[model samples]
Target: MFNQAESFPTLQVLLYQGLKKITVVEMLKTIGQDIGPSTRWTIRQDLARHSVKTLTSANAKEITAEGVIIDREGNEILIRGNTVVIATGTRAVNDLYERLKERVPEIFLIGDAKAPRKALEAVAEGLAVGRTV
Candidate 1:
């Protein structure tokens, strides 16, 4: 079991078998959720069944032909894979919003394009916008 207690506020990812499955777990002590031993054991068993390799506390430094180069507690670990999926949260790129703002006087921007946040926030924003409209 790879403990990611050192890196907080960063996402720790586990890629299984050449991009067959990707599991993203947040490594923030303040915001992290605790998983019981049984749950962890079950997860391990499932991964083992599917031949999924788990890399813990891995901070991706770069992507290379070998796979993703990660920094784990100062030691570099390379995860070999044919496919790599990088899930970097949401971003607010309001190119369309800016363009439409001139043509449409009243416009509401919702979701990640407006602000990169949780689905709950986006859903709340959507409901608020819907009520206004």
Candidate 2:
């Protein structure tokens, strides 16, 4: 989304999570994983260049006829837009693949089914698979 934000004239990302520096031990204990520092840096740079407004510690509270209301640290903010996108994080799921792999002679898993990452990575994989087909 950060990379594609340039296509939208106005885009705002409201994240309910807080941005803070934490110890490695705290991170591993709480989240059990971390987004690599280099990837974070690249995303930050892309967001900065693309003019993607980010509201950290903000969440969507309600959607009324007026617009979408947000709670940013207890302050109510009304944002009026044609579209509202609620983005949850991505995770890999291979339940169907597991069930069908043995039954099907040839089955190729691409994109999120293989591993959840950026869209470009998935697209590249899809193109490669399409060529084989």
Candidate 3:
């Protein structure tokens, strides 16, 4: 986001530039990193994925399939049915917003967008320029 005044002038100019000779799919593909969704949204399920139920605590970092804690402190580690495991990647700055957007809906992001290159120092410079300009 830019300052209140600078935020929309460029966007307004682009919007008023008259319709381009591009198809909707072409435009969405260009804007959405060249990959569009293959199918429409559906209230559907694929049965190949299995589902299991278990009560999980915030501290239950990892566990085995048979409802067993792989390494944790619990005196009542006694009885239970099958468990479930989900895999996720380590956190990186950009993708965290993509994943957690629903949890925090009012969101905004900005930086050296059209700049030719991306790097740690370049990102820092972009943020600094964003703050000032």
The TM-score between candidate 3 and the true structure equals 0.19
lDDT score, candidate 1, position 33: 27
Per-residue lDDT tens digits of candidate 2, residues 1-133?
Answer: 3565433323333232224311111102222134577677776665555445665555677778866777766788876655565654678999999999999888999998899886887899999999998
Off by over 4 Å in 2: 1-34, 90-133
RMSD of 3: 24.1
The list of candidate 3 runs beyond 4 A from truth reads 1-58, 70-79, 87-90, 93-133
Superposed Cα deviation of residue 16, candidate 3 (Å): 50
Worst 10 residues of 2 by lDDT: 21-30
Instruction: Give each model's whole-structure lDDT.
Output: 0.66, 0.62, 0.37
Per-residue lDDT, model 3, residue 77, is 45
TM, every model:
0.54, 0.42, 0.19
Q: List the residue pairs that clash in candidate 3.
A: none
Task: State the lDDT at 2 in candidate 2.
Answer: 57
lDDT for 125 in candidate 2 is: 95
Instruction: Rank candidates, lDDT, best first.
Output: 1, 2, 3
After TM-score superposition, the amount by which residue 84's alpha carbon in candidate 2 deviates from its true location, in angstroms, is 1.3
